[model samples]
Target: MSEKFRAYLIVSVGLACLFVTSGVGYYGFAVLNTPVGDEFEWSRGLIMWAFAFFFIVRGLVAPFIGRITDRFGSKKIIICGALTAAFGHFLLSQVQNIWHFVLLYGLVGVGMSGMAIIPVSSVISIWFDEDRGRALGIATTGVGLGGFVLSPVLAGFVIPGFGWRMAYIFLGLVVLALIPLVMIGIKEKPKNYSNDKEDDFKSPDFEKNDVRGVFSNLSFWMIVVAFFLTSMSNTGILQNHVDFLTTTGGFKLQVIGASLGGVGIASTFGKLGFGWLSDKIRAKYCTLLSFIFQAVSIIILLNASTLWMVWIYALLMGLGVGGWAPLSSVLISKNFGLTSYGGIYGIVSSALCIGTGIGPLIGGYMHDLTSSYYQAFLFLLVLYAIAIPAILITTLKN
Candidate 1:
């Protein structure tokens, strides 16, 4: 194979591995929340706070991680992230107190900042331009695939057989195993690689601006704001769907959980399909479609009474939510070149993380205060409507 093709394969594999690790590590909480709450006699809100805390830590650490990737390169940062994630899972496996849960999950959050989409997508952005959106979409599809395949399987089988702690141990070991693959296979774009005797691909022209530069760009701010709102709405659904079904819709916990897995499966295809579509059309339009789809899903979820209704809502929501991941990165790459792409993406991702951190907390809190998630779902619908305008404004020339 040519060096360019080989580079794409290596970077794509690295992104897939990183997504699998971070998805499982970060989302393990969503599946295990009931088990943890039951074991500790904690309120669901309290258990969800752990996930919130994780996002907060991820948001705070993301910019630094991006700066490090920009300055030093992605290799060391990815390896360090993988190992740190392994350690965090190890600590989680042995947790005895709420504080232990907080501390361990905080570390996991930091590790997620290191291991998640920003670094992986940055590397892929460096490797391919013509097919960047599709490449990123394929790489990130790992997260949805992992969740689709692992969440139900782990919750139904592993946790039942070995308990949640042992499940954590197994997850930690699996993530640790990827470290060697990342180290051996992953490489930054070759210093010598070029296109057509012109150095354009070798060192693409872009301003080497910091996070402040990103803040000054109206497009960047619009993307960030829209993403924040979308993330908040998305997280509310993902984190609370099971509870919402069980408490208000009168469904069994297992049924609700499995249906969420169905959402995951739908999301896997959504990510890939929307990503390819972004390459064909404008990414901003794809993003707008995703938000609209998600808003409709949320409305459907609010009124869902039968299992079939829940399943349909899950699939639609999954598609919309899944599409957002790749489309967001593609838009960023189109607006800003690879120069400081990691840092700029990281800042936008920090906004997303912040929204995610607050979503579940507010969702759970609303349930606690109102005795239902109806208010939260309605709130999400409004946010989605707001996001449509935000996204439209992003497409306007500044």
Candidate 2:
């Protein structure tokens, strides 16, 4: 293979593995929630905190990983992330207590931070320019595709057969197998490459100010705040959707599992479509449109009483929510440039993780308090509305 093609293959494989690892690690909690709750006689709220712990650790670790990627490159970081993820999954297989769950999930969070979009996208962004948007779209599509393929299988088989523990062990071994590929295939461009040459890629521009500088940019703040609200809306709905369907909509577990899988399929298309569109249009406009779709989907979801209604809602929301993932890096790259892309994007991504971490916790807690998802769904509607104006304001700026 040509060196360039080899590089793309390596990065693509790394991204695929990262996406699969993240999909299983993050959504594994959702599939296992009811099973774990039933086993321990724990409340749904308590079981859901495992996801919260994952997001919190992801939020804290993202910026540091970004910085390390900027300074040291991605090979070492990705290898470490893969290994941590493998170890974390092994730990998850052995968990018997709440603290064990928390610690293992936290390790998964750290692993995700090291392996997630920021680190991988930073490397991909550096390697291509002519097809950067398309490349990124292709890379992130792995997340939606992985989820589509795995979530239902997990819900139907893993949880029912050897239990969630064995599922973790199986997933851990799979992630471990990818580490050597990442270590060998990924590389930064030659340092001597001329930025002005047509064939050479230009690095992102960074202001001399450090991480604190990102806080001063209004556009950065808007992206952070908007992403936070969106994350809350997305996670709140997804993490508890099965429970919501069972308790409120009177759906069977098979129906709920199938619907979740269907949503994952829709999300795969959404990620690709929005990513391709972002390349054609401005990323800000793409993001705004995605938020609008999410708002409408949430409103529709609020009134869903039948399985079909919920499925349609899930499809629409998946398109909107899944699209947001690729557009995030596009918008950040447009505004900040690549020089500080990793660190700055990492900070913004942290806010996203925080929102994701809290959304399900708050939603589960609300359900525990009210015995219905109505209040949480309404809260999500309000958040989506709030995000619209923030996106408009940020996009309008130079």
Candidate 3:
């Protein structure tokens, strides 16, 4: 194959991989929460805890996975991740206790950590330069697309027809099926490959240093803090979305599924839009704009009682949340360079994952205590407000 075709092919394969990993591991789990809670007589808080714990595990292992990807490349890491994730999902289908469920989900998290963003971004970084933002944006849309297609499939068909157990099995099988694609399609960076963006790392003294070097830079920390807050806010809303709709708005599963699908669609557009914007304006400014979208969506959500209002909320929130993945990759490359990108991005992702883990737990428990999502959503809004200034500060001249 020609060099240009090979680069695009990597993107295509990466998108497919993310489609299964994020679809089954993230959005699919959200759809299953209601039925899973009902079957086990678990509270929403407990269900949220299970997911929170899973993401925490995913975060904890990300650095190791990134380092591995850097040294060994994507194929091995993806194969291993897909196998582990498939096993976890298969076993998760058999769990009768919450503890077993939580632990197995953690295994799934570990598997997904290997397969998702870090390695994909690392490979994409090595391939494209000038068009990196759009390339990353296009590749990561698999995340939103997965949510769009899988959410309805689970809610409307799989769970209803074959039960939640069969749904997990189906997810496991789909993940396993991705291994062949990776084996055949992915390629390591050529030995002669080089990037001019190395000069872009903000720290001069630490240019040759390891991951510790970036720690001394203020922009790095700002990016971390900003994403942590945004991630926590976005994840809190998404994880509890179905429960919120059912209890607060009294929506049915089919309707809620469609709403979730709407989020996926909006997010897909958000990723592409913000990605293209990253090339035009500063990455931090694009992030600020996305946050504005999210904050307004939350406001709409708080008072939403009608179907149209909820759909509006979903569109705004999805667009806002959608920017995080591609923007995170862009910000990292702009601030830290790509020589050690996998490890550095891994650390940022770890922090982001921590926020993702905590958000749902906090949102769920708040609902348990107050018996309403009003207080919980307000907490998220506060996080968004705090994050805005943090992101803006990252764009200032050193």
Best by lDDT: 3
- Candidate 2 vs candidate 3: the lDDT winner is 3
Candidate 1, pairs of clashing residues: none
Residue 115, candidate 3: Cα error in Å is 0.3
Per-residue lDDT tens digits for candidate 1, residues 1-398, read 66677676766665567556545765677877778779989886777788888898898888889888987777778878878888898889888878788778889888767878878887777777777778877887887777876676678799999999998887788778777877776787767644333123221223334455555567678888999999988897789888888888999987887787788778878888998898888788888999988999988899998989998899999899888768888877666656777888888888888899889988998888898889987887799877889998764221
Model 2 C-alpha RMSD vs. true structure (Å) is 2.8
- Candidate 1 wrong stretches, greater than 4 Å: 194-211, 396-398
- lDDT scores of the candidates, listed in order: 0.79, 0.78, 0.86
Residues 1-398 of candidate 3: C-alpha lDDT, one tens digit per residue: 88888899999998988898889988888888778989889998998888998889988998888888877888899999999999999998898999998899899999999999998888887888788889889998999999878877887799999999999999999999999998888887755787655665444435554577777777778888988888888899888877788888888866777877888999999988988888778888989999999999989988888899989999999999889888989888766777778888898889888889999999999999999888999989998778899888764322
TM-score of 1: 0.93
Which runs of model 2 end up more than 4 angstroms from their true locations?
190-212, 395-398
Which regions of candidate 3 deviate over 4 angstroms? Answer: 200-206, 395-398
TM-score for each model: 0.93, 0.93, 0.96
Ranking by TM-score: 3, 1, 2
lDDT (Cα) of model 2: 0.78
